[model samples]
Target: MTRKEQTRLQVLNGVLEHQVTVDEAAQVLGLSERHLWRILAAYRKEGAAALAHGNRGRRPANAIPLGLRDRVVALTQKRYQGINHTHLTELLAEREGVVLSRPTVRRILVRAGLTSPRHRRPPQHRCRRQRMPQEGMLLQLDGSHHLWLEDRGPWLTLLLAVDDATGTAPYALFQDQEDTRGYLSLLQGVIERRGVPMAVYTDGHAVFQSRRAGRDETNRGGATQWSRALGELGVTQILAHSPEAKGRVERANGTFQDRLVSELRLAGASTLAEANQVLGDFLPRFNQRFGVPAAQPESAYRPMDSELDLGSVLCIKELRRVAKDNTVQYHGRSLQLFPSMERTSYAGARVEVQERLDGRLLVRHREQILTPQEAPALAADLRAQVAEGPVVVARPDPDPTDWNPPQRVKTPVIPGPLAGDSIWYEDPARKQVHRDLVLAGMERARYQGKRIGRPRVSERPEFEQQFTVVVERIGRGGLSRRQAARELGIGYATLKRLLDSQEKSCTKPATSLSLKPDTGEDY
Candidate 1:
């Protein structure tokens, strides 16, 4: 009998002998006197055997069969290789029609000495920061580039946002890459659905923060397009120093990588659109299952102002100067800004050119939207064709010579008769002063050891005398060109050049032998 049964039997024996009262035995066994009386009756008739539990030696009613457990282990080792225990449990229920909890499946595998493909890391102590008291106070934004469609489709990046307060995903989408435009669209969706968040927590991705590789953190440098968009919407952006700093989104990425990939595979989502559809269906359930209510009921998210347009706020914005032809060139495309009611032309005006999420180019000046037609190919020539006003031929000053072009001639320095009405002569005093200033500037530059002009061609190198002696030796048949090159610490080409130059300077006969017959090939 089990120790618990043996103790109960001893207490009942004491009660029967009158040494232990009914109340005392009941208290010892932690049972009511009515139940104790029933136990006493059974023990008096059946002896110590009645103390054992009735179902102690019987198998549980819901016990899994050996065949099913073996099948699961075989699948884990073969078909479902590399699948985690938790994911395998779900797949078993959905596909294999073998319903089981993760721990039950894990138990079967552990008994079979089979382990999960991925191992859990030992938990480390970390000081987790408390979540924001209200939703929309802080939302973690991140993008994960992973094999969402496995081998069936191209790799895609999933842009995700998780609320710090509720641990719920507000909006997520798939993109070809993690780009400035993708994050902007993500923020736009979140804002439209749940209102504008007070702030965002993100990593130091180039989309979120301006690159300052060699600069100090104290120097923020400048706002990136994403940061600028947030600023325009009055949303504060907090850059995380490490993954743990933004653990909410980082851990969400890991969970999606594990579960979402399996979901996409199970749904047979082979295309981006199909994957997104599956994702859309999955997120609501995910939020419902995992989301918790915030500590406070009131939402921290500020209501979007009716006047503030999300399309204008959440997009890539750049300062573009309107070309003289009233156009803004962006990414090899010309955005032609037409005249607004207040202005006749945007030419020479610095305007904000926004590439909206819908791929529309918006040019705004002083918050006024300017719509312009897409100038066709060779737009510059087209603008030149459409003149703003009348074509006026620039003519000379209104006079007798207005019909004739004025002729210009220079007067002689010696006061000759070459001067004309439109002619002008150089001033001698001004020229002298300029000359003096230039000379003084050159002297100052020379004193500062700054080179004044193109490097002077060396008339003669300092070692020319020594090189000349070596060349003469080679010419006199005393030293070979190779020998002379090594002795003078110069190359064979240099020695040969010296020999040729010496022959020309001294008018001496050539004494060096021709090294090789010309191949007659152009170098």
Candidate 2:
């Protein structure tokens, strides 16, 4: 029985004993004296047992059967094991046609040892803070870097915008990294969904904050491209001094990184698209659990500025003038503009030019917009004639034997002492051996001639004599190892072996190379 019903029975017991006056009992019970006396007379005539409620013995007509309850518990244990109570309840209702409230199903599963493991919640601290009065009044924008796809792919950044009051995720997208382009797209989506919010609260990321030019400047100045774009749309950009200043978006990012990862896994989302689709369905349910009513009824979102040019503002490019023939050149593509009857010359006039991310041309000359069209065959012929020059061929063909190998310049090799500097022997044969060895080593290092030495390392003075001959032969462009070996009149494998040994011994770190100023591409 309820506490009020139990108190009423105690009062009736006091009345039956006549220990307290009916007027005093009425005052204690907070009831009228007339009603208390009437109830006491009725109880005295009917006896104490008759005062019990008539509906106490009746069972609820909609009560679930014990057998069905046991079946649900068994199903939960067998099929829906490890699932959360809400999900388990859904699965039971959908798959087994056994509908039960989440709490009832949870109790049954717990009794049957089918309960999921309990997670320890962090300690809560009460603080005085106010959320926006309505949804769309303020939006918390942030990017979260997460391993959304587990080890299946590289890390991705989930850019999200959450409504401050209702916890509604109006916009969310996945990108490889957090960049200005990603935020532009997210902002575009937000504007499209619920119009412009009163203000956007975000951390002091470089993308949001303008860098100060000097120390004397009190205000954060030098408007960034992003800030300028937002300014044109009349959206106030608020930079938070600390993360706690923009706690809503920061906290939302944390919650999503934890719960959204699990949600995506449960939904079997492997790609960004699939994860986004599941997020659409998961956000409303998430909000219902966490959201609170706003302080006021109406939203503060203003209508989007009609004069805003979204495309031109979001893209990065400079304006250029079209030539006399109504054509602009960018990235080697000639964007031609056709003249209308009202216009005469198109020379020296500023036009809106945008290079889209996908490398498309959008040329706007006043209200007249023009896309590039392929020139007519006649026009193409004239242009080709004006642009092209004649090609020249050189005389060729020299006799095979007459093609003598280039003269091999013999250079001196400084040999190491055979036994601790005791003798400095000048053996040309040994020098030749070392030279052959070094060349053969270079050949192997160059991937068997698949990739030539791109000069990633500087020429070591220790191998100056050996490298000079090799560099000369390679610079000539037609000399081959076989020819070099033939010129030296040494066995091919012996020369190759010596070269390989020299390479193995001369392994130096790449940092050893000297960084010189660029002098064309001669080096």
Candidate 3:
């Protein structure tokens, strides 16, 4: 039995024993005397059994069936375990055929050991303030930084403006950081969507508020660039003392960080584009649940001014007229601005020259936006003539046959079987032999072009072969390997191997007839 019923039984017991008066028992238990007397009578008639209420055995008429309760719990555990009971309940009815209240889902979850863990914290202090009656009367603008893409990407700053009355987010955009450009672009979007609001509430960001000066102490009489733009459109800008002062957007940021992050995660929004697409559908549902009604029945937003030039107001530089000579000077460059159509004259005339944020030039005079026109052929020719400097001509070279190469002299060679052996010849004409023999001797002489005298005989292969054997013996006999290898162009090991192989072959004995050395006279 519940504590209340137990206490009622105890009060009845006190009344039955006559230990306390009915009025006293009733007063002690905070109940009517008649109610206490009724409890006492039921206890006297049915003993302790009557102390139980009649409704104890009665089942609730609208109670869900056990099977249905089990099914709902199973569905929640299987498909929506981590989802909140309220959202789960909605999903249950929508996705499945289960119709259950949020409280019923919560009860089922609790009984099934699925209650959400509660965090312990001290009591929070809250401030109470009334919002404006009309939706467009006040807009709270701020930026929130979060890991909007989970682990998929870097953190992004969300620049959002929420209506103070309806809590409706009319403008939201993702940026790399909260900067002046972000707010300027955000304001432009808000203006385009909902027209001009009555007033805007924001923190003291330099974009909306003057840092060096207060709202009433700016260079142009307390007006910032954004403030000036708003003033030009007759919109009021209210600067908040702190983040809490503009509590609407601040609180909205908190809600979005929690609910929106989950929403984005569930929708598989890994990029800014995907998040924006999902946000379009999520904002309406979120506003319906948390938003309050506006105080005024109608909106207070004003129509945008017709003659207001949006680009010029948003951009940093002021518009100026383009000078003649088809040129509009800015910063340092002398920009040449030409008219597309055939105009008789543009001298001493007003032409709007828009200096863009990225330092680009756009000239607009009257209602038409002027463009450059191509110069005529005659004008181009005149410009070329008036320009300075003389032209130089480059011609091709004369015929190749006109040039002659240097002459070269022929040399003669020695004769005999030794012709094959590379030998140096002193006078080639004197050593001339049979044409074929001379050719063969010429090959042996190893005639290298353009030498003053005969090349050293030691350069010949026959000289190197005999010199190598002698050098190897000299090395083992006394001299260093470097002296021996240098004469043969072979390393120490190669010379040593040659000597070893010669000794091995000599000891192996002669298998063929030995020939006598040539005794022919020198050629």
Candidate 4:
């Protein structure tokens, strides 16, 4: 017997010998006197064998059969090899007519040395933040691109919005990829279904923010397209510094990839439309199963304002100048603006072109909505009216034979190549000219060498002329050479050279004159 049975047998033997009372034995075993008496009677009859449970060695009536276990294992290893435990359990019940609970299926598979395909890592340590007190206070939005349709369809990005308070996914949409338009449509749908959220928690995606971060964004393309949309709606945008900070939505992404992918496989959804349909049908059930009530009863969502027009607010707007012919060209499509009552024509005026989600191009001058008609393309007509080549006409009798060969001069003279030009030194006249030029350059270099190029201010005649007057002023002991240099807009070295070039000019910025460290630099 095990330790518990051994203990019970030891206690009961003492009670049978009358060495211990039934009350003490019951208290020691944490049992009542009546139950202890029954155990004592059975122990007296069967000795140590009665200490064990009667059904310990017997098979349970509701136990799963060995045959069913074998068949489940066989099917798991054959048909559902790579499926997770929960999904395999579901598949077995639906496809194989096997009525087994998930735990039973997991037990059978694990006993047969089969493990679940999905391997989850251990959780890491992080600061856990509390959820919002009420719904609509904050919404965590993110995009997860995965094989949601597996190999049946193309890869799609699921733009999901999860409410922070209740952990409910308010809205989600399948997109070709995570783009600004997809996010715009997502935010628009959320604003229509649920009211405007107080703030949004999301990652630092390009759609939600600009790449030129922490700088003057106004000059650098301002904000991103989605950021502008959020600003128009007056919603606060919160950027998550790391994935762990937004773990709720990130974990939701992981959960959906695991469960939703299997659900799509079960529904046989092979196209984007079919996948969306399945997701729509699954969202209600998912919310009911997973969503929880918030800490606060009242919602924090601000109700939609009746005056706010969602179409104009949530759209890609572009500023286009109206053409002189009363047309606004957007993406090569000419939108001809009709004259409204306020103005005769929109030509020479600026207008905003809003590209609505429903593929409608709206031209607006601030608040006035102008009617626009698409001008037909002129490419085909222009191509059809093209001339094949320049119009041809016979040359006017070739100028009546200027080939009369100008009998005055039949052979025109042409200058021959200067083949002997490289031998210029051999020419006595050219050599004398070059010699004189070299001698003249050497004489100038020797005579007025300091005045050849632009000279320093010291070498200038005016600086030398003003030297005596500056020295007389500095001799009064008020101004320094550095101060004089500053007032005259010249370097200290230039001023000192100008002073030293004259006779007995020693009020200079030199080491001999620098009696103290502050000597010629005093103001």
Instruction: Arrange candidates, best lDDT first.
Output: 1, 4, 3, 2
Residue pair clashes in candidate 3: 133-295, 133-296, 218-222, 326-337
Each model's TM-score?
0.60, 0.49, 0.50, 0.60
**All models: lDDT?**
0.78, 0.66, 0.68, 0.77
Q: For candidate 1, lDDT tens digit of each residue in 85-204?
A: 987897888789998889999999989998876688999999979989999999999999898888899999999999999999999999999999999889888988999999999998
Better of 2 and 4 by TM-score: 4
Q: Candidate 2's residue-wise lDDT over 361-392, tens digit each?
A: 67767776556654333454554553343232
Please list the residue runs of candidate 3 whose C-alpha ends up more than 4 Å from where it truly belongs after superposition: 1-83, 110-127, 212-224, 311-336, 339-523
Give stretches of model 1 more than 4 Å off: 1-62, 74-81, 90-97, 212-221, 377-523
**Model 2 TM:** 0.49
lDDT winner between candidates 2 and 4: 4
| lDDT by residue (tens digit), candidate 4, 1-523 | 8998888888887887889988999999999999888888888788888888789889999998889999999988776766888877777877899989888888888888998878989987777799999999999999998999988999999999999999888888898999888898888878878889999998988888787754643313767767877887789999999988888999889878887887787788998899888888877766786799999989888877798788887887877788888888888688888877899888889888888888888988978987688876566544433322222323222232132221221222222223332211133343444555555555666676533433444344555335555666788987888888776556687567555654353465332232112123323
- The positional error of residue 482 in candidate 2, measured at the CA in angstroms, is 36
Which 10-residue window of candidate 3 scores lowest in summed lDDT?
A: 513-522
Candidate with the larger lDDT of 1 and 3:
1
